[model samples]
Target: MSWAIIQQSLPMFGKGFELTLWLSFVGIIGSIVVGLICSLVQYFRVPVFRQIASVYVEISRNTPLLIQLFFLYYAFPVLGIKFGAQLCGIIGLIFLGGSYMAEGFTGGFNGVSKSQVESGKAIGLSRWQLARYVVFPQGFSLSVPAMAANVIFLIKETSIFTVIAIPELTNTALDLIGMYYRSNEYLFVLVIAYAIILVPLSIILTLLEKRVRYGTFGN
Candidate 1:
């Protein structure tokens, strides 16, 4: 195996990695928000939103992330929709992550006690206060484990962005492979790159789960 040389095209890789991280961060945030909105709508049994959320969750969750990426990348153009590659990646990640996040939120919403919900109402909490102080806190806390898991899942899923040409971490590695003409070395770099990302993410989430497990959020 040829020895690995650090490609001086470092800025390119940096840009790609930054794009990956930013998109993942934005996607996670967006999906969580979408999930919260959907979960709340369904929890209240809102007539229209609930039906929409139900069908959306089922469809998005049922589809593979890669196929969804392709749908946005390839299929959307057939309908006269034009999205940038980055935008397509972001949207794909959002929908994919939203499905998992919504399921997590739904589980949390279901697990929350009705009495607690009523107790909030008994205190004369307004709709905003009820959701902000009462429902969201408990529901989110109860879902912390799920949230952590979702974070990890979505991070890994970001690799799919390469399929849509988002130039993420994997793309950088492939770039190095062709440029360096050292397949094994670049493969090692690929493993190292992902390992660097995955190890830290796992450790962080595990610690988060520990903190949440011992904390009193369930009432």
Candidate 2:
């Protein structure tokens, strides 16, 4: 409602948005890598690694990002394992997002037809070769929708970074509200900032999903 307040807050919000983008980008990438590793471990039923991956997924998925962030930012320092707030934020996002991504990827792997796997075996494809050539491609394609959802989820989860005093968008908004007492204006700006990033991102992911679904991405 107060354009002046909103205008004055733009620089702060811009900086916060920049940090949010960085955190989200790093988190998404890390989560994808972690998820891929875990899912592959499970898919292959690796000896000890499969059990470890399953336990890790269960723990990560069961816990809240806030709790994980607190442990990383607050609890770990008590044990002499300290990380900066930004690092903690990134780790928290990856920790939580990775589990969801693993599940998504596992689902994608499951969606791979059994006959196709058999066919790959019949062709004398090694396990690794089959995974690289047949399984990974189809699984990733099947995973597009879930991956998009998880990316969006991780981006939104960055809001929780405020608890760790990360200068992300939500923190910026809270600071503005505390300083000016214009909760509505700051909240509106916060919403708009997220919309600016997420709206286009959502549209792009949707388009990518459609392309993957019908445009021969995995084939």
Clash totals, every prediction = 0, 0
Per-model lDDT: 0.81, 0.94
lDDT by residue (tens digit), candidate 2, 114-159: 9999999999999999999999899999998999999999999999
User: Best-fitting candidate, measured by TM-score?
Assistant: 2
Residue-wise C-alpha lDDT for candidate 1, range 1-219, written one tens digit per residue: 543264554566577667777888999999999988888888778998899999999999999999998999899999999899989988988998887899998887667688888998999998778778877777777788898889878978888787777788877777777776766766675666667777998898888777766766532
Candidate 1 stretches greater than 4 Å from native? 1-4, 7-11, 114-134
Candidate 2 segments exceeding 4 Å error: 217-219
How far does residue 71 in candidate 1 sit from its true spot (Å)? 1.1
For model 1, state the Cα shift of residue 191 in Å.
2.2
Model 1: how far is 138 from its true place, Å?
A: 2.0
